[model samples]
Target: MSGVVFLILLLLGLPLAFTLIASGMVYFAQNPELPTAVAVQRMVAASQSFPLLAVPFFILAGHVMNCSGITKRLIHVSNLLVAWISGGLAHVTIVLSALMGGVSGSAIADAAMQARILGEPMQASGLSKGFSAATITVSALITACIPPSIGLILYGYMGNVSIGKLFLAGLIPGLLLTLVLMLVVYLQARKKGFAPTQANPPSFKQILEAINQSKWALLFPVLLIVTIRFGIFTPSEAGAFAVLYACVVGRFAYRELTLSDITTSLSESVSDIGMIMLIILASGVVGYAIAYEQLPVSLTLAVTQVTEQPQLILLMALAILLVVGVVMEGTITVLLLTPILVPLMQSVGVDPVHFGILMLIMVTLGGTTPPVGIAMYAVCNILRCSTTDYVKAAVPLFIAVLALVVVLALYPPLVLFIPELLF
Candidate 1:
């Protein structure tokens, strides 16, 4: 009955946090012996987690990197690397996304920023708006896969998985996705008659200059990995280092970060942190309710009854997560579902890190899909392309991504290779 009410409230469009609190309140009312103070305690305890401190620090670091002019330099370097290829601008979008993945770690933000910066130029250069929009949305998936990803952080926190392992594990798969998407973009551009932005490949001197100029931005992720690997800091502590690194790089190294920029970055980080923490807090309540109702055990038993094969069960779970992600916010879905699914995966002897990567990919990919995909809407709105056109342009790319997901699923080494090598 409590579960039903909670679903009804969520479907009726109440904010997730409010629906959670309201549902918990009703559960309390139905059992007067249950103390209302428990809700307060849970909410407070959720915020008190040391792992969660990574969330705010990373958020602030992302904003700081953007404000400090690191993002623009990275974009310039990405352009230099790919602008000589056929469908150069589209390749630019892909490469830029992969680079931005390390800095921003938010797909929606990457899509919107890319659309704003590159959409008009691409359209004016005879590229279709829908194609541009599709590429931006899909490539932005890279952001969610890279290190410092908030999605991975949340998954680690809720699933009791190692944050550093998740971060290291994503490296190769993310680059592979980039390579595949780049090929798709090239073929699509050839089909559509999209020409290279530059007639010749950039000279070695130009390439060297671009790299030197963007070295600071490039070194950020390396520093993070080294710091975490050496046990110099936990993932959360590394996040604090990230912020300080960005500040120093922006203010002293690049001489671009100003006092005003620092203030604005803080303001942006505060709002982002508030939204994320609220969803997480609400999810903590929902998670507690799910546990109180024995949802995980029931779900595990039901799923095991249908399939004893670990791979098949994982595929089924991935399919469910993909569908759920199409409508639900990725962070919310991760927080709500990780607990329910992790134990089930363990029962089947699947590595939690591998499953975590698969789960994160599904949810993040969902944001690029239709109906309620936040990144999709963001890109389409920026490009002024119809949903139908975007979907048409996106179909081939979507198929490519789905195929990649299948390959990753069938061969877990695609994700595990990097973590094993690095760790």
Candidate 2:
């Protein structure tokens, strides 16, 4: 009953947060034995989580770093490294996304930032608007897999997996995504006669100079992982450190951040934080309802009645996620599905950390597809490209990313290697 309500509300265009809350409330109403106050209590209890603190702090940190001179320096470094490649600006867009992933952690934020900064330039440099928008939107998936990824943090929290391990786990997959996407850009650039941003590769000295300028930005993610791995701070506290790091880099080191910029960043952070937290809070009710209904148990039984091979089970789950991801917001999907899916994976002898990383990528990738893909709408809007055209231009890049997902899915060791090595 609640599931039906959720779908109807979601399709009716109710905001996602409200859809979860309302659906959960309907579930309680239908039961009649459970008190409605449980819903309110559940909502309040959700905010009491300490680990969840990472979400807001990281979000604030991303906004602050964007306003600070960090983004500009990173952009310069990306340009120096990749501007000589075929489809140079496109490569820069992909590289900048990988770099921004370490700093921003939010795919939508990275996509929006790159679209604003690089969108027009790509088109002006003779790249099609559709391709430029697709590149900007899809490359942002790197942010979801990189260390300090907000998706990983939430997955860890909900599934009771190790945040530090998840952070470590994301490293290889993120880099692989970057490499594959760059290859796609190179091939597409050649076919389209897209010119390189530079006639020749950057000199060694020039590359060193650019890296020197962006050293602080580059050091942030490395320091974050080391601190977490060594028990210097929990992932939640690391979010605080990230904010401090961004502020110091922006205000003191680069001297580009201003009081006004901070005020604006805070304002934007509040909006993002509020939306995310509300969905989380509402999800508590939905989560409680699902558990009370023993959805996970029922799902496990239903799934196990089939072949029950761990790999086959994972593939089925991934297929469902890809479909739901198309119509749902990634965050909402994570909150709603994590509880249901994690235990199911564990039952079949799958590593939770491995499943979590794959889950994050799949859900995050949904935001780049059609229908309700928030990141897709954001980038297309910024670049003024139609969805149809964007999808057409993005097919090859999409296949490249999906191919990486398939590899990671079949070989769990690829996803788990760094986390196992460090932990």
Candidate 3:
């Protein structure tokens, strides 16, 4: 009865935090022997986690890097490398997304930022707003798969999975998505008569010059991977290093960061931290209620009964996650569902690291999809493209992403190979 009420509240558009609290309150009301204070206690305990410290620190690092002019340099380098391709600007959008993924791990942030930077120019250059919006929005999917992804961090912290392994596993799949999306962009651009705006391919010297300017920004991810793999730092410690690195690069290397930039970055980080932590803290009570009801056990039993084959089970689970993700925010779905699903995956012999990567990809993809995609909203709102127009332009890219997901699902080695070789 309580669970039914909770679902109804969520369906009726109550905020997730409030829905969680309301549901738990009802449970408490039904069982008068249980103190209402337990909900407060659980929420506090959830925020007190040591591992969760990494969230804010990494978020701060991301903001600082963006403000420090690293992002602009990256865009320059990306344009130099791909601006001569057939669908020059479209390809640039995809490549820049891959580059920015290292610095901005949030997909919505990446999409929104890219839209503002590229949308007007693309429009001025005879590109439709729908085309500009679709490319930027879909490419932001790359950010969701990069290392230090907030989604991966939340999954690890909640599911007791290895953050480093999840980070490593995402590398190949993320790159694959980039390639696939680029191909789709090329085909779509050709079909639509979009051509290279650049007069000629950049010279080797030009490419080298661009690389030299952006080398500091490019090195950030390599440093992070090396530190984590060599045991010089844990994931959390590396986040602190990232903050310091961003500051040094901003102030000394780029000479673009100012006191005002620092203050603004800090303020933005505080707001981001507040929203994420609030969701985490509130979801703790909900997680407890779900566990108290043996949701995982019941779910495992039910799934096993339906299918004994691990691959079939995984497909079914992915399908369910895709549907739920279409409606729920990616981070919230990851936090609330990972705990319920990880143990079930373990029972079916799926590697938790691999499962986490797939889960994150699927959920993030949902945010770009139709009906209720948050990232979709962000990009379309900024471009003033109707949802119908965005969908028409995005459908091919969506199919491309789905194909990539299917390939990764069928061949686990695509995910596991890099992690095994590196870690």
Candidate 4:
């Protein structure tokens, strides 16, 4: 009954956080035996999680980097590396997304940044606004699987999986998504007759200079991972380090960040943090209801009644996630559904870390999709592209990403190899 209400509310365009709280209240009403105050307690408890401290710090760090001119420098470096390809701006957008994944962690943020910075140039260079929007928005899936991905962090925290393992697990798949997206651009650009930004491939000297110029931004992820791996920082503390690193790099190295920029970043971070925190708070009640319902056990039984093959179970879960991603906001999906799905995977002998990367990718990929995709709307709005054209241009890229997800699903090592080696 509560599920029906929640879905109807969601369909009616109610805010997700309120919908969660309202649905949980309905559950409490139905039971009457349980105290209503439990919901309040759970909501407060959700915000008390120490690991959640990372959310705000990371959000601020991303904002700081964006305002400090680091994004432009990274864009310059990506262009030097790949703008010589057949689809110059398209390739740059993809590579920049991969790089930004380590820094920004939020796919929507990365997509919006690129759409604003690259969308017009792509148009000026003769690419359709729809294509430009689709490419930039979809490329953000790379960030969802990269280390420091907020979605991955949330999954790890909620599922009690090792955050470090999840980070390493995402490394290869994130890079693979980069290559796969680039290939899609190559084919589409070749067919469209899109010219490379550079008439010729950049020389080694030029590439090195570009790297030197962008070294500060490039070093961020490495520093973050190294600090976390060696016990210099916990995964949660890495968020604080990220904030400090961005500040230092922006102030001393780039010499571009200003007091006004910081004020703006903080103001923006507050908005993002408030929204996520509200969702987290409301989800606590939904989570409690699901647990009280023993939903994971029921799901496990339902799944096991089929084949019980770990691989097939995982495939089904991935498929379900892909569908869910198309309609749900990625962060909320991770927060609300991860608990339900993780146990089901564990029953089939699947590694939670491997599933974590797959889950993050598919869910984050959701934001690039239609009907309710935040990143999709952000790019289209920025580019002033029509949804129909955006959807049409996105079809091939969707197939490419979906194919990559299928391959990754079949081969666990592709996702787990680095985590095994590192840990």
Q: Which has the greatest lDDT? A: 2
- lDDT value, candidate 3, whole model: 0.85
How high is the lDDT of residue 417 in model 3? 95
Given candidate 1, what's the lDDT at residue 305? 94
Q: Tell me which of candidates 3 and 4 scores higher on TM-score.
A: 4
lDDT of 2 by residue, 278-303 (tens): 99999999999888989899999999
In candidate 4 the C-alpha lDDT for residue 288 amounts to 93
Q: What is the lDDT of residue 370 in candidate 4?
A: 84
The C-alpha lDDT values of all candidates are 0.85, 0.89, 0.85, 0.87
Per-residue alpha-carbon lDDT of model 4 for 1-423, expressed as tens digits? 999999999999999899999999999999998899998999998888888888888888899988887788988998888988998899999988888774454678788888888999988887888889889999989989887888888888889898888888888998999998899889998998888878899899998888888988899888888888778898889999898889888999988988988899999899888888899899999999989999999999998999879989998998888788877888889988999999999988999998999998888777788888888998899899999999998999999988998898899999999879878
- For model 2, what is the alpha-carbon lDDT of residue 194? 91
Q: How close is candidate 1 to the true structure, as a TM-score?
A: 0.96
Q: How many backbone clashes does candidate 4 have?
A: 0
Q: What's the distance in Å from true for residue 357, model 3?
A: 1.0
Q: Residue by residue across 240-349, what tens digits does model 3's lDDT show? A: 99999999999999999999999999999898788778889888888888887899999999999998788888888888888888888788898899989999999999
Itemize residue pairs with steric clashes in candidate 2: none
- Measured over all alpha carbons after superposition, the RMSD of each candidate to the real structure, in angstroms, is 1.6, 1.2, 1.6, 1.2
